[model samples]
Target chain A: MRTELTERFGIDYPIFGFTPSQEVAAAISRAGGMGVLGCVRFNEASELDEVLEWMHENTDGKPFGVDVVMPAKIPTEGSKVDLESMIPPEHRAFVERTLDDLGVPPLPDGNRVDAGVLGWLHSVARSHVDVAMAHARKYGQIKLIANALGSPPPDVIGVAHDNGVQVAALAGAKDHALHHVEARVDIVIAQGYEGGGHTGEVTSMVLWPELVDAVGDRAPVLAAGGVGSGRQMAAAIALGAQGVWMGTYWLTAAEYRLGATGDGPSTVQKALLAASSRDTVRRRIYSGKPARLLKTKWTDAWDAPGAPEPLPMPLQNLLVGEAHARISQADDAGVVAMPAGQIVGRLNSITPVAELIADLVSEYQESAARLGKTLD
Target chain B: MRTELTERFGIDYPIFGFTPSQEVAAAISRAGGMGVLGCVRFNEASELDEVLEWMHENTDGKPFGVDVVMPAKIPTEGSKVDLESMIPPEHRAFVERTLDDLGVPPLPDGNRVDAGVLGWLHSVARSHVDVAMAHARKYGQIKLIANALGSPPPDVIGVAHDNGVQVAALAGAKDHALHHVEARVDIVIAQGYEGGGHTGEVTSMVLWPELVDAVGDRAPVLAAGGVGSGRQMAAAIALGAQGVWMGTYWLTAAEYRLGATGDGPSTVQKALLAASSRDTVRRRIYSGKPARLLKTKWTDAWDAPGAPEPLPMPLQNLLVGEAHARISQADDAGVVAMPAGQIVGRLNSITPVAELIADLVSEYQESAARLGKTLD
Candidate 1:
């Protein structure tokens, strides 16, 4: 499982895990794979700085990374208040009607919901990158910074390179990857349509090689999407990827099971474990983008005929934030929205991060050995 | 490139090419890869028998296969006339209006178009299968019989087995693959969303592994969809596919370029070469079912508002047969409907079948070697 990615990132394996939890990220780093904390959930620079500080303190000086959502085109380009005004009234009404129809109860008394759309807009995400870079400079432990939506801006790429951190961007198509390379990013994560979050129509088998043939020599291409096992990792490498960038597989890890409060699997984690690959649907019901998520009454309601089309980015996120908060507090499995990938079919159990990494390494070795025998 | 697929089929390579032209099919077999002749175009059993006889005489004792479209559920189980009667007048008017709007000229004088919808119905397809079985029984060189839409009927599978011919079926999902295995299919071609003709939403990366995990031990799985390069073949093999079943790549082969009468590439081929991967769309314009096809005026017209939706199976195919004849005769690239996968981006040039096979072999070896180095 050791490739140029392993040596470059100073990890035992080339598998990179993306998670929002600091504990899971630290566990992944400790297990010899790079754990990248998703910074999109953090609304303030102070919160992000705190998480980075926590990660640095807990991982025993192991290297990890941070991911921020920085789409090239933001729906609105001002303060969160201005972005909220851009959301259409009909879109907001539709979201409310859907939750009302689904019988998703509101948050418990006195639990106020935040109405502001925080992470998806350009200003917020740019601030996120700035804060992450500042924390990386102070801590010297963050080795990678990944832009989730599009190519990282030139200045951000420059700052990351100047700070000795590799910059990576997720591309669902070859053209996106070529643009990323042109932007001087050090790594390209070619995420396929089967991937959990934002994706293009191209699948991993086609997207990996197309990106590899287009820009593999220029940058280390990491295959993302439907990679839940060691054999899948071997396949990604064989398809010309230097490593694998996985997120959904780590959701059910033991570290994630023990949440911020040291409790067992979250409601979302339980939903993910019970899901089959076919259970997920790519719909714009949550984030205004076609993100793959668990098929719940929330998603189904939006898909029904006469439902208003979802607003773009910041607006859509704004419209759904309160509804999402309400559903989460209610904790009803039927209406809870859980973002996942087609790889969920293989995620039928929970294990420790170290054991998951070991299983991937062993499966990869066995697959390689089998192919070698055939070659012989 | 040798695997159990090669040994079982007695071919030098495990790659199987599916094409409607006998010339391309024979050329593929002559070049060491199995070529399965697509039999949907042949309306008459006599025409199919003649082509099979031609393939037998041209392949020089090499093995080949046959492909028949036998969808598990027929839209209409009655005769061609009864099915044609089911097509509404509005559907016929819409087809006429579309051809008129596209400026597709009528066929030349003395060239009468066949009005019968032949390939999609159960009776017609079953008769085609019976003729193929008879030919296979008569000629021992045909080693495989593939069902394009679904699992071959149990009796057909039994007959093929009795005649020492293997049965293959195309599956777009894991459940479909399991059904094929349950039906005792010797080979399951797990095609992804990127595949041509009919396909499910599951992409090759997800579909290949899911199908492999479900039925790899029960039956040999052939990875299909978006497989246009040797690196892709290596990826499929690593993902647990025994071999690859390819179609769109052969459409631009030199053999296809040199048509049955030694002419140039067909209008569809020219259109295919000029198009990008994004140019193809999965629509139910030509066939009643969703199939990936070139985005042309033919498909676009049907998608326009106020246009009548296409009728089911034989009815839709029947309604459009004459319109297709007019477009092909007119040689209008903009109106020509060509079934292709997202891999159209890589088919930039035409090459002979032998060179294509050699390139694939060399590329596979190179990719395997690179992975071997990483493993060390």
Candidate 2:
């Protein structure tokens, strides 16, 4: 009856959902759980503000959270990330040709706005976080601040705690999980290999217990990666996890803003199968940051024998951003891949957000019942 | 460049392995491949001889095989199978008394074998195949036959193949791999799901492409489920396979066999950290048949409420023969519940057989290069 995270997150069930849409997030929270909005995709500042304002008017004051990226590596250090000039011309040419072949529109040749992953670094991520905070204050119910990439920098951590908002970060390994603990972070989310964005070798079943052991009594471990069903949620809890952090599951939720077509993660199972671990070819093709995704012709071209390699953070971000925007909206998906975790095999059908949450709880109850009898 | 098996089996490689040891028929004709033994902890006379002696002696003088079940799968086949009699009321009563108190066993008890599986279909597995065909006639060569339970069946498949004798087999999913296509049966084996005895399931990364997919392609596939070593091998190749089978990958190699101490699997990093997917669980009590192994005690009482009941065939075997053997051995393992498929974890160290075979072609090339590259 008394697990640390159950009370901390204020939920009857310790299931946390992450999504790129606000409606899905709010619904998960309103269903007696927590939902965090993924905040890195908005290309403009006003867009971020607009979404947050909408979230404020809609949530009816339920608890919610925001997520951003702060990877361990970056291209530059300064108040602003000037992404336009950092990428090489050859890379840009290749992307331009790919877009042309894809029949997607190119930006007008004129006054350049900051262009790639470098175009969306701490400056961009923080801008969205600022939007999250202003709106959280307006609504007075946002309960947490989470870093989707690496550790939350000291300043971000300090600010969130000051605002009575719990700060959380993602970790791919046991060592990284410890980094979260030593930093006094409220949660050290130990992710397994089957998660959506970035992940590591161990599976959720194997990693959950390891994290519980490593973080002993220090931080409540929020298990992330490879979770898409109620049985899985129950299994995680049976293995000692205090809560479950989920993202990929929400991609198919009805209220999410993503289009029904060409969302690589949506039709994932139909295309790929049988990789030892995953088609996790790390490329700075999106956000100019080295991210894992299903393999595609776009990645193969960069990895081809003679292609110019990817640049670091912001520069790669600058180089790939527009291309990301274009391809995501195009039909040549085989030529361009998208971010995904290995759990895609199980991401088969679509269901409503509230139904998904309710099913998970019911399944969790069933699994617990199964496990309890075995122990008894 | 030459090893005993290479010359004997007349193939480029001599690493023979498979799940069901009696698959001596299909394994032998798996051209240029070897079929070891396993899965016959509960074998019969006719079943073993037909496939081993009858089939092996007739297959274009090609090598054939047999294997045995050692550790892994707690609940072997039970009355669910067509046994002459169900595990006596006394046996069931004894099983109940043993499980009064215990949590997670010494393990998570990956997978368990039940006695109800074979359900008293008392037939000599390839073990009898190994035994009944003593001196059938000479053949191209019997690469090898191995076993997970006791030593060389009644007559190791090699003896029947004559002077150019060779044999091998491992446990775990070995049951699924034991069928001969066409060839003189030479080997019978058993490779545990765990790294020792019979095993399965836990170590997903270990590879034994030889057994899992050899049928119809010349020889038959050879697998010992919990094989451990390379990360990429986990991407097993059943590419052009008739069937894919496995067992845990741990054993009594020339240097590691026991010296009357009733040896258990090694605990080195290669074994311990291998992976549970290649491990096993204590299933049946052992002598009565369910495999005796190291694992969680969960499998011992699978009939608990709401637990999906296991079926027959191999299920009852877990609780019969092997369970009895463990109790007689008075090994504390009796309570640990023997079935094991997670043996791959103990497969940390490599022995001469498989390593030598995989390396043979490379070594042959190395030798050829020393002599110059154009021999072909």
Candidate 3:
């Protein structure tokens, strides 16, 4: 499959894979699509810098991208202790109670959670940009710096452009995309409500075309949300998206498990593998914004009566960081908080990233051919 | 544009337009797509039979269909009085309070809201089927009968088949479609959450392909949701839908305003035409089940804190039926409760039904060509 995105990036296909694992990102790049490594997990620029170095060596000279959590409206920057203090006591008590009820053990000695909200702060995102610019100048391997929440600030966009790197931002609504285009972002990723993580109320079927029409030629539109297969890719292209920005489908990739901290498939991956499309809920407990997540016991608890309202962005993450770490360590699939889309129904097995990309390409081809036949 | 639905009905395109107006339905059928008249508004079989007669005369010998709300599990059949009494006083008070707050006028002298829940009664749906079967046998214009809620009872499906009418049912998930296929539903419409009226939680982008895969060869899948443009039609086809089952787009048809009881465009139509895709809310107030509707003051009032929870199905309709009539008569666009999908954003102008159908055909062709070019 080819489109404006493929031509712009000189990639073979119009699929852009977003994953937290550098290995999965590199695999997607080597397999002819852009693999975007999510940088939000890194607490410090040095950690991200080391990961980018590893990506530069392992990507086989192919271009890959990095995604960072940079809110358009910058939040107050502070130390971890200061951030933790902002979280309400009631909210902390609720999290502690839920984690205890779920039987999630405390972190082992010397494993305290730190810098949980650092990536969310504007200062930390500036550091992330500094690291990305350095890699762009040194090896010319950092081709894209994508902002996960919305458009990066104008100065950040300017810095990326000056460093010869493209900028992408996620918009869940047409008006937001228009603002992104106005902000002069290089690419607009229109993430619909059915997508994993942060999203808006509109579905992909309605949002993709609306954004394409609204953005016009100002920026290329990448359709995200519930796009797991080649048929879905064709649907996105048919709706005038230049490409697909997929994240949830990559959570089950074999390489994702390899790069994960655990020895075997994590609970998140297992839950995703067994889930149907109906097994997802759009809850605000994830990041204080509406995000589609697996309908796990943990999510259910937050939605249950008497559960405290989740705080805003960085605060919500701060409140739940330790609980998340404990749940991950507990290795129970029922209560782990994993951001996934309705497309979880289609991803039933753990395939290698390359195989998954190949399947998408073929499925896209078959779908395109099928549409052509219908026209005939 | 040829697919199983188009070929089965010998229509030129695979668009199935669902509208409550006989004029709009006939116009769609005459313009090369099958227009299915929504029968839920008719409280009596005689009224529906007369409307079918009008449709038979107006459709220019083209095949048409009718949609009836035959809930899979039939609700307790009751008289309007019985249904009215079942609604609690608190729910009735909430409706009255909302109407008063919106300043909606009560019905004028000599007018009364009667049989509001009759069409929703299982007995009424059976009568609807009887009228449709009669038309199928007499005129052969009633080519398809679609059940709006899940699969029709086996006896209903058998009756339609005996009368040589094909049966279609709406499903929001793969398992629901599978049950429909097992019940021998001739067509399965995968109605996504973005669809208007009663709907399930899954969006079309994920649900269509899931239903298609599950109902493979057992029944053809017709995609129903936020399909407003030809590009959306192409997307639906690419995702394995045999055709598009559209409803919300018809609300703005010029012919609809002609049939509506108003001097000009009704308040509901005005609200729909002015709405953006983001202006819709999925709420249970429209029906007892979650249905997408225009974000109007009436719906907002119900969602507000201190508002009584909407009762289930017939009871909800009974409680709010008079309030709906008052809102309609008051001609206030801001407070009307109208079922509409996110595609309302694209339907800005009141175009003729034939012109709309023609545009969709050309758009579908263009989108298919666009996808072909991408493959190159």
Candidate 4:
């Protein structure tokens, strides 16, 4: 059956869908492949339990996975405090002044943004990973665990593998892949510069092959940078890859739990282009570490020239997370930006996961069929 | 102070460098630049005199150009014609006979390869451009030219342009102010993914602002491809551009004198990678398409299931094009490739001049750049 991977993962197809929404995870699993939930969104313990229970009831024992944010670098105690504490009052003053000059008027409607929004960005991130692990232990659908940023911590790895679950991590550079190997990650996702969110500066054509060369055939190599279509998936395999790991593709799926803010369609093109890597400021703005986000007014104000850099790890994310929440609820397009990949270029339209998967298989079949002629 | 290009082409920057010795034609004159001779080892034409002398003395005192073959694209074309081809027509016959036994070698190279040395690859390439143009007119340094392929087209552009000449062409990707552009081409260049001939498909990153952008109020933009580099160069100038236009970079450079001998470094890489799109291959093949190369016997053989792709452009280069003179002179690693665009990664590197220049800047820089970082 040329089923090496299917035999290993126990999925009908070798495809693996990655999404930030837990609901999307269940949907993909129900469709026959693997679906991984981005557990990073759930900030509290009880909230995670309820979500896991819901997934179990909905998916009816289908296999799925979870995603968490674990940055490569953790901030030191002195610098990892609340934004007001880590950043000098002078730095904070600069941000306010820049916004004032930009003519950013005070929020109308008695509150332009929730005052508590920017406070929980970090603790929630760390807790999300912990919570995912706990949920995996309680649920049968969780077969894998992934760290969104770098390699999962040894403890996280222990919990995953101890329970017979595979571990995967996202990486941009050759150096990062090396770290994952050291951490013994079961899969090394060599994402290219075309990938989204705080990506490394190397394009996939160059980076994927380089990683394959560097890693050899130790663990399966999943190409995950600019993949949005099946033809692209075929090209990745032709270049020597085990399978394709897709994330953004799932964002546009009908089952995606992305409740719209009423700005436009739930499509990447409409929402992503308006975003700048700056908008998705890579400050330790959210779950700590540098994360690319939509360049929101808050990110802009915080990132003005000569402004204090955001704090790191759990602390920095903790300080400003409340801001993320309130902004999402505020319906202000300027404050809410999707943490998407450069592959957003391919997210031209939205379709169901079933349709997308069928397209992948069909496109892949067509690519092979065309190449078959060259062989003849 | 000569300001090199100013004294030569009456413009700015000296970033001319490339394959196709004849590319100097429009490449030099249009930018108020110079051209050089790309004389290969076999360019023993004494008739070469009339060409250089005429150009030295004719052509509206405009800059001229020239170039030479730079080797690249390892495992070049000689393989099929080598002892491998010598495997006894009987062995080849037997292999052909047994094709039904194998499940189609799995890749293009396993299918079939064109045989024969790419006749008169470089010498004829360098000979005709500056030689023919110079022979046709007495343009002098104003008739400056470049050896689009190898080492300064044997000092012709410099010897004459020195007497008030201009020599210029295209560079691979990276740019240092005084390097080639700094050497003295009245204009500077910025080629991106949309360009042709031995390109790296880097988009405008290393192509535009890096070159056109790096100069800031300095130099002009001869943006090439998807360009013409123009929309982008126009955008580049928005980022900043001055003057812009580029042939298929190679085809446009040589001015149709290249006739179809397989040795023009301009399209070597295309002959290496077999896929017919920009994505199939991304590496430095012939003459350093560090941008992109055509798929061919040279590239395919190396990327084989168990084979190693060539080294960097410089290293792999030793095998393609002009090396065919030594096809029988040596082995399989020395011939069979050309330089073109990453688009050659899409198809052949050869193209028409109008189409080539059309993609570069054509009064489009201001709006394009404005769009890139537009405040609106």
Each model's C-alpha lDDT? 0.82, 0.51, 0.87, 0.50
Question: Model 2, residue A163: what's the lDDT?
Answer: 70
Q: Evaluate residue B76 in candidate 4 and report its C-alpha lDDT on the 0 to 100 scale.
A: 30
Q: Provide the TM-score for each candidate, comma-separated.
A: 0.96, 0.54, 0.98, 0.51
User: Candidate 4 A-chain TM?
Assistant: 0.80
Best by lDDT: 3
Give the poorly placed runs of model 1, Cα more than 4 Å off. Answer: A110-112, A257-263, B110-112, B257-263
* Model 2 spans with C-alpha error above 4 angstroms: A43-45, A75-83, A100-119, A260-284, A287-290, A300-308, A332-336, B1-376
Please give, for residues B167-269, the per-residue lDDT of candidate 1 as tens digits: 9999987788889999999999998888888888877887887898899578888989989888888878888888889999888888784222237667777
Every model: Cα RMSD to truth: 2.2, 21.4, 1.4, 19.9
Q: Clash pairs of candidate 3? A: none
Q: Candidate 2, which CAPRI tier? A: incorrect
Residues A1-376, candidate 1: write the lDDT tens digits. 5788999978888989998888889999998899999987777778888888899888888889999888787653577677778878888778777777888776678465663347666777788888888877888889999998888878889999998899999998778989999999999999988899777777787788888888958998999988999888888888889999999999888878422233666777778888777788888867877888887778888889999888877678878888877877666667777778888878878788999999999888877766665577
- In model 4, which runs have C-alpha deviations exceeding 4 angstroms? A1-4, A75-84, A94-130, A259-269, A273-323, A330-335, B1-376
Best by TM-score: 3
**lDDT tens digits, residue span A144-202, model 4:** 78776778778778878877788988877777888888889988887755454556644
For the candidates in turn, chain A alone yields TM-scores of: 0.95, 0.85, 0.97, 0.80
Global lDDT of model 3: 0.87
Residue B92, candidate 3: C-alpha displacement in angstroms: 0.8
